[model samples]
Target: MPLKIYNSLTRQKEKFIPINPPYVGMYVCGPTVSGESHLGHARPYITFDVVLRYLTYLGYKVRYVRNITDAGHFEEEGREAEDKISKKALLEKVEPMELVHKYTNLFHWAMKQFNTLDPNIEPTATGHIVEQINMIEKIIEAGFAYVVNGSVYFDVKKYAATHNYGELSGRVLDDLLETTRALEGQDEKRNKADFALWKSAPQQHIMRWKSPWGEGFPGWHIECSAMATKYLGARFDIHGGGMDLLFPHHESEIAQSFICNHVQPAKYWMHNNMITINGKKMGKSYNNVIKLTEMFSGIHPLLTQAFSPMTIRFFILQTHYRSTLDFSSEALVAAEKGLKRLWEGYENLKKIKEENFDLPDDNDLDKKINSLLDELDEFMNDDFNTAKVLANLFEIVPVINSIKDGIIEKNVLSSKTLHRMKDALTVYLENILGLQSLSQNNETFDGVMQLLVDIRKEAKSKKDFFTSDKIRNQLAELGIEMKDEKDGNISWNAV
Candidate 1:
């Protein structure tokens, strides 16, 4: 099946056709390294990670770029942004650059825990100040931006007159002008619709740099447009971010490119819906956010218990990208149970004996399984419907378990078919969907555990009740658990 992606600009799913066949370039808006990433932050990165993974699966050489916003953007007008990093430094009593580095490393750590693919290039707004300046110059040269009090602002009216400024987002230009808050920025910009390109730095601001526009910093939206174009060229295959950015942030990016290069920057625009808590946005202002580390450690007030990053990944994948995923402890618990059973069944399938897959083959179960696997490409191709694909996978857990229990057939499948299915399941679960089992104890630990279990079983068989119970009770004190299976064989797992 051909890959299809829902284009945020077009507001419809379209066949994915790369600008250059066999090669694709994608850019995603990454975190601003001002603070620790939160649960709300995981959606877009995971959304695009699977996009990158599946494109690679489809045999596309994909170069994925996601930026880190280290250069602080304007939080309000007339006042310098308490520089995102500098302000963080002040609060934490550290240097601004140190704060930036700290959070950047933290974000990377969180991404690593999530099993997200590292982008081909992680351009930083601070590092690409020159590219941002150049892009601002081009916009100025093209008469779509003007300087005011040392600050540069995009001329929204002119750009909108020439190009469809609201193409990427459905926001009407007039509505923006009408509804724009009459704030301090109203005086600096020519119109309410205009946005910052390069924000002039005030004396109070310390993160200033010498630019063509005097000592100033690039605007929030300008950083992405500049860096994406610099690394991925003026036009790329896919650009993605959270839906919150679809309006002013991503909309301005399109306007900037149209004004300077006379074209949209990306062929595909994808937006993931927000992760909400109690039907409200999970944000700092909302005060309901679960910090990524908090979620990982189960230290957040909102989380009922701790959840592994893999369980979180599975929970996210069970929902469509464009749908609001309500934050719930119950939902995560369900996902954990589902993943545990699914993964355990899949693991056991590896050791199952295959005398003859005839019974299942006679029922055309292999064909049915293949048919489901075939639809994975179709589901993923349709704007990366991870939810549907995951649901399809969950539907087969019973079949896998039945095979492991010797209740289903595997003999009919040739080695190639069996291997293909296994690979598909692993790739989708681990690589694309980014799900992994909780890290298990090391081999040495497992060996000791097995030895303990063997000794306990031997004691039980010989009716050495005191010794067997003592070993079991001692291990339980150390948080080890044991379960005796139906066959009287003892199985132990670490808690």
Candidate 2:
């Protein structure tokens, strides 16, 4: 099946075709560096991270660009007020860049913990000020931007006259203009509909820069349009962001790029549905967010218990990206158990060797496994219906477990079918999905565990109750909680 994507621009699933053959460009809006990212932030990135990995796995050279909004999105007038990052730093008495650095580092660490593939180009808004300035200049030279009092504003009314301005987000220009009432504090802008291209900095603004518009920073929307065009060119393949950004943020981007470069920014306009908590938007403003760290440690008041990064990953993957995922402690606990059971089956598939199995001359195991594998690709191709793909995997899990436990006839499978089944499981589990076991593979760690187990075994053999219980208690505290079998061997894992 050909890969299809749900384009927010078209409001339909369209076949995905890269602008350039053999090379694909993807731009995903990344974390804003003013604060630590919450669970809501993880949805879009993790969704597209799989897209990037799957594209690469299918032999496309993909350039993935995810930006860092470190120094943008702040108040522009009145008291020379601080930018978001700067304001937070002042209230906390930390250096401005220190906060950016800390959050940026934390975002990276979180991505690593989730096993997300690093983007090809991770640009920062502060680093691309020159590019932003250049784009602003182009828009001005093209007569689609105007400057008033040293601050530049995009000429949205003028741009809309020529371009299909509302084509991307389905916003009607006339209604928007009619609904936009002038706010009390805005004297510099010619129109409320015209957004900031370059915001003039007042004396109090800490993250000020020298721009064509005196000392100011690029607007929140302009930074992305500028940086994406510079890194990916006038147009690219896929542009993904949250569905909430489809309005002012993305609408402005389309207008700016069309006026400045005479082209649409991307071919596939992908937007993941919003994450919700108790039917309300899971957002920073909503005050119902579960921070990624809090979710992992189960420290937040909202979460019932701790959840591993992979459990969270599986939970997200089980739902189609275009469908809203509801958050609850019950859902997370269910995901944890589901992932553990799935991984156990995958491990068993590895342990079952073809040599030990009885086989017919031409077993149909290959056909069965091939059908499942084909469905995996089929669902993914159908607008990235990840939920369907996961359901298919669950269908085959019982078979794999039965093969390992000798509950089913395995020798009836031919070598070719066996090999394909193994390959299919590994590819889907590791390569395309970008998921891996969240456990260390260190030999030293295993050896130490064995030694401790041996000590406990000796204690049990010697009838020393206190020693055996002490070892068990210490390991449990360390998350190497013990699981003993009827045969007397002790197993442990950090869950």
Candidate 1 residue-wise lDDT, 1-495, digit = tens: 699998988889999999997999999999988888998899888888888989998999999999999988655545535566677677888888998898899999989988899999998888988888889999999898999988899999888886898888787889989988764456888999999898888787778888887998887699889888888888989999999999899999998887767778999999999999999989877878899899988987768988888888888888899999998999989988888777765665565544443343423676878888888888998878998898888777787767654465446554544555677888888777777765467989989988988998899999998989999889888867676665477866563
Q: How much does candidate 2 score in TM-score? A: 0.91
After superposition, which runs of candidate 2 have C-alpha atoms over 4 Å from their true positions?
75-82, 181-185, 356-366, 451-493
Which pairs of residues clash in candidate 2, taking residues 3 or more apart in a chain or in different chains? 357-411, 358-411, 359-411
lDDT of each: 0.83, 0.83
In candidate 2 the C-alpha lDDT for residue 160 amounts to 82
Tens digits of per-residue lDDT, candidate 2, 133-207, equal 999999999988888877888877788888887898888888877787664225666666788888787677788
Q: What is the lDDT of residue 48 in candidate 1?
A: 84
Deviation from native of the Cα of residue 132 in model 2, angstroms? 0.8
